[model samples]
Target: MSKKKEALLAQYAGHITEKFSETPNMAFLDKVVTGLGPAIYNRDAALVSGSDESELETVKANFLIKKLGLEDGPHLMHAIKEVIREYGASERNKYRAVVYYILARRFNKEGIYK
Candidate 1:
């Protein structure tokens, strides 16, 4: 993984630990991050390291929709691209942070992360 992704993951781990302060489920958080982290890392790495941009976006869109359980549409596509640009344009490492944030928020709302 890239240094940037490593840093973001560390930061998120701290936040997760703090968020679960009463119970302090670092084990669960660790499991979640470790289990899901590599895929996010590799996808972003491919986006940055690979040559085909359009193909990557298509693949990324598919992955995001499937992983996020979101509907496939132009709006979701625009939102994905917008989030990427909003967080940090061309910064693959930061992209995972946003993706994780989205996923975490969804899980939290579903009472899975809490």
Candidate 2:
């Protein structure tokens, strides 16, 4: 991921944590942050140490799917992209959090998560 994207995901993680603070479960927040930034950074390390495409995919997918265990990954992925839009408004992560949280809440309520 680009540095720009890495920064975006960080803010997204903070936004997610803030918005979902009332929720009992924090699994998704943890899962996504694991899927990005350090995740890419870690992959770079693995590749430098000689990991292949299949090996890399296996590692990334396992973290994104199995660890996150979200029922709908594509939606979550999209929401992350949407959260990326907030990178421009770094000081306004709270705004982005509100927006994405609503997106997530709706996705859940509409059964999109299933």
Candidate 3:
């Protein structure tokens, strides 16, 4: 990994550990970050807006359904809401990689990264 990527990964790992009190699987997290591509370097793109319904819909449609091949249903939205809740409603900087990591694991889609 590049130095910048490493730094960002470390920063994200810290957020996961400190905020969620979970020790992340480094390999999985690395793949999640790498999969995110250049979007991670963009400040606005890197963050998930829990308050935006459209943004959440995009995550469900694009990431969950399209990327992970999950079927469309109410449960998907419920899962997204659950993740946002877990991330904390009041939390402003909900990193996209962390959110994706949690969702990927929630649905047992880690193999997609492998």
Candidate 4:
């Protein structure tokens, strides 16, 4: 990984450990970050807005359904809401990598990254 990417990954891992209180699987997390490509470099794109309905919908439609190949249903939205809750409603900067990591783990879709 590039120095910048590596630094960002470390920063993300720190946030995950600090906020979520869980040590992330480095390999899987790396894959998630890599999969995100250039978006990670963009400040706005790197963060998930838990308060935005459309943002959450995009995560469900694009990431969960399309990327993970999950079926559309109420459960998907429920899962997204659940994740958002776990991520903390008061949390302003919800990193997309962390959110995607949690969602991927929730759906057992980590294998897709491999």
Compute the lDDT of residue 73 as modeled in candidate 1: 63
The per-model lDDT (C-alpha) reads 0.47, 0.40, 0.93, 0.91
- List candidate 4 stretches off by more than 4 Å: none
Q: How far is candidate 4 from the true structure (C-alpha RMSD, Å)?
A: 1.1
Candidate with top TM-score is 3
- Which of candidates 2 and 4 reaches a greater TM-score? 4
Give the 10-residue window scoring lowest on summed lDDT in candidate 1.
16-25
TM-score of each: 0.45, 0.29, 0.95, 0.93
Q: Can you write out model 4's per-residue Cα lDDT over 40-80, one digit (the tens) per residue? A: 99999999998899999999999999899999999998998
Top model number, lDDT: 3
Give me the overall lDDT of model 2: 0.40
What local lDDT does model 1 show for residue 12? 54
TM-score, candidate 3, is 0.95
The total number of steric clashes, by the backbone 3 Å criterion, in model 3 comes to 0
Task: Choose 1 or 4, whichever is better by TM-score.
Answer: 4
